[model samples]
Target: MAETRVGGARIRYDDVGQGGPTLLFIPGWCTSRAVFRKLAPWCSTLHRTLVVDLPGHGESSLPGMDFENATVVDILRSVIDASGARQVVPVALSHGGWWALELRRQLGSRIPALVLLDWLVLEPPPAFLQAVRALQTPQWRQAREGLFSLWLQGVSSPDVIRFVQEDMGSFGEDMWKRAGREVSRAYAQYGSPLRALSALSSPVPTLHLYAQPEDSAWLDAQRSFASSHPWYQVQKLPARSHFPLLELPEEMAARIGRFIDARVDVGNPLDRLAPSPS
Candidate 1:
């Protein structure tokens, strides 16, 4: 466990392994680095890995800072610099994908690749949007619990279930309220994860790993995007949970390892794969 101060807030992270092009793991909203406990250590064997607990989550302290995009990116940049990593591959989970994209936008070539886990990369449906909006109202707790139920539809793993229940349960009302607004703000800014990826100034070798087959439409959208964009790819994992990291960490690590070896270990691989836009 290591710590760095960003904007007077203490950010905590785990720095492990040793090599260039470090794997930086960013957990989703209201979740801690513990979400990456198994994944990060496994990746560390292949390359240096840094798993962070964003301010106000896990062991980190927020003090007076707001948990917005810029603040999160600043903390991430500080972590990368403190670890002396010249290059990074952000393995972001859920909403953390937003921050990962922003970090890449800020750092450019320093970000070699991106891996998104179980994020809604397409435009959300009206019901989904409505559910998120409800999180800002007085009934936020009920709304959050309902969303959690939906996300855990097919999850049967005891560990995964307990983690989600406990982690989400641990947040206070203020944090939940803030998370609701931040999520809505992120969508407003980038439209969707697909739009954000497309808007990148440079094509980044990216992968979206998901486990929800119930939403066939969302899965199909991801496949469609990946089919057209050589720099992007999507894979649906067999895990029956939204939190595949907790359910199938070894498999996730193996998949990520293969991606790094094939697309990122080489020099400018996306250049050879991604055609120049006319």
Candidate 2:
């Protein structure tokens, strides 16, 4: 892991492999770059893979940075600029997707492609959001201390469960609060994922991988957004949880590879492989 100072944070990132069209991997909340350990190697074979531990997660340091959405976007941009990669295809997971969207917004044509893994793009029901916010009180945070381990285990693989347990255990309550606050603040400031999608003017090809137990509203929102922006496409993964990357890393990586290949290849690989539209 290499270190670079981006704002108040000392960002830690992995820049490995050699190729054009760099692939920037961003893990979800509370997850370190370790989540992409298996996936990175495969991707590195084809493109330079840059994986970063977002501020306050993994080996990264957050001197005094706050977890606002805009702040995160700025930090991410700084990291990419510092990396010296001119063009990149951002592959982000969960909360990291927000930063990816913002990157496309700010950088526009500089980003060749965008990939999202089970990202939470839709605003939950108003009732659900209200209930969730109510649970964020310090009292509730203290009460729900070990509950995440149990809930996570039910949805994720053993490896993912272990990672979450160890990560949450290391920083305890403070880290937990920071992660939650970041997501809540992002939602509050930016509105829904639909709003973010609507604001984008770039036609950069986007691939959204959504996991199972799909929310209807989320599907509808993506559909509507794609209607206006045809380059944005969504695919449902077979996994049953939000952490599909942890549940099926190899499969997910392969899917991402195919997507990137199809978009970036000089001539369409699918066109050569598929029968002539008959």
Candidate 3:
């Protein structure tokens, strides 16, 4: 494992395998880079793969203004710089999609490729967000345990459950509760990459992957995001849930392995997302 000190925050990251065409993975909210435990092994066998924990999420401790000012853009900058790869591909999922979008916005042409595993691309609109805020009002907060409760319900991954249990169980429920609440506050205020996505904002070659057993609503949102890109590839994993990289490791690896082997716009449909920069 390698660590990088950036913006006074220590980000824990690791590099796997050796060679050109590196893959950098960014996990979803409340999850660790360990989420890629399966995918990393497969991808590393064929290409250099880097898996990193975002600040406050996993191995890294939270900076003072962690979510207050920490944007995925800056995070990726640190990761990319540390990798020493002029062109690196980002493999993002869920909230990780926001990070990937920011990457393309600032380094569109520079990114060799992008792979989004069920990334968030479309928001429910201002009205919906406002409604959510209403739902979070004091009256509702008491009635409902919290947004974190709903979010946990949304994620149906045994692997995630086990990881959080073994890794964070000692912290007690209060610590986890506070962490989840604070993260929810940040999410409510700073989530906009979905609506911010546009061809002008992102012209990088990209891959969008979704699992069939996952939420169709989310899957539709993912497809909409890929379609909006004007140039991107979309793949639907069969018989898998939200966390196929962990749940269906072998199949997930086979899919990603095929994608990596094909290279940019050659002999691979997953190459559809990112066409060679014209």
The 0-to-1 C-alpha lDDT of every candidate, in the order given, reads: 0.83, 0.71, 0.61
Candidate 2 error regions (>4 Å): 65-67, 131-136, 140-153, 214-228, 264-278
| lDDT, candidate 1, 1-278, per-residue tens | 78889878889888877655678999988888888887887887867788999889999999473567677888899998887677789999999999999988999888989999999888877887888899989999999899889877867898788888998679877888888888899998889989989999999999888887566777787778888998998888888888888888999999998888778854543322321111
Tens-digit lDDT string for candidate 3 (125-223): 564345345443544443233433433455567775565455433333333444444435545655544444443443566666766435577666666
Please give the RMSD of candidate 1 to the true structure. 5.8
Candidate 1 — what's its lDDT? 0.83
Compose the digit string of candidate 2's lDDT tens values, residues 85-139. Answer: 6677889977788888888888876687889877667775575354345446675
How does residue 27 of candidate 1 score in lDDT?
91
Better of 2 and 3 by lDDT: 2
Query: Candidates' TM-scores?
Result: 0.93, 0.82, 0.71
Of the candidates shown, which would achieve the greatest TM-score relative to the real structure? 1
The whole-model C-alpha lDDT of candidate 3 against the native structure comes to 0.61
In Å, residue 229's CA in model 1 sits off its true spot by 0.8
Candidate 2, residue 109: the lDDT equals 66
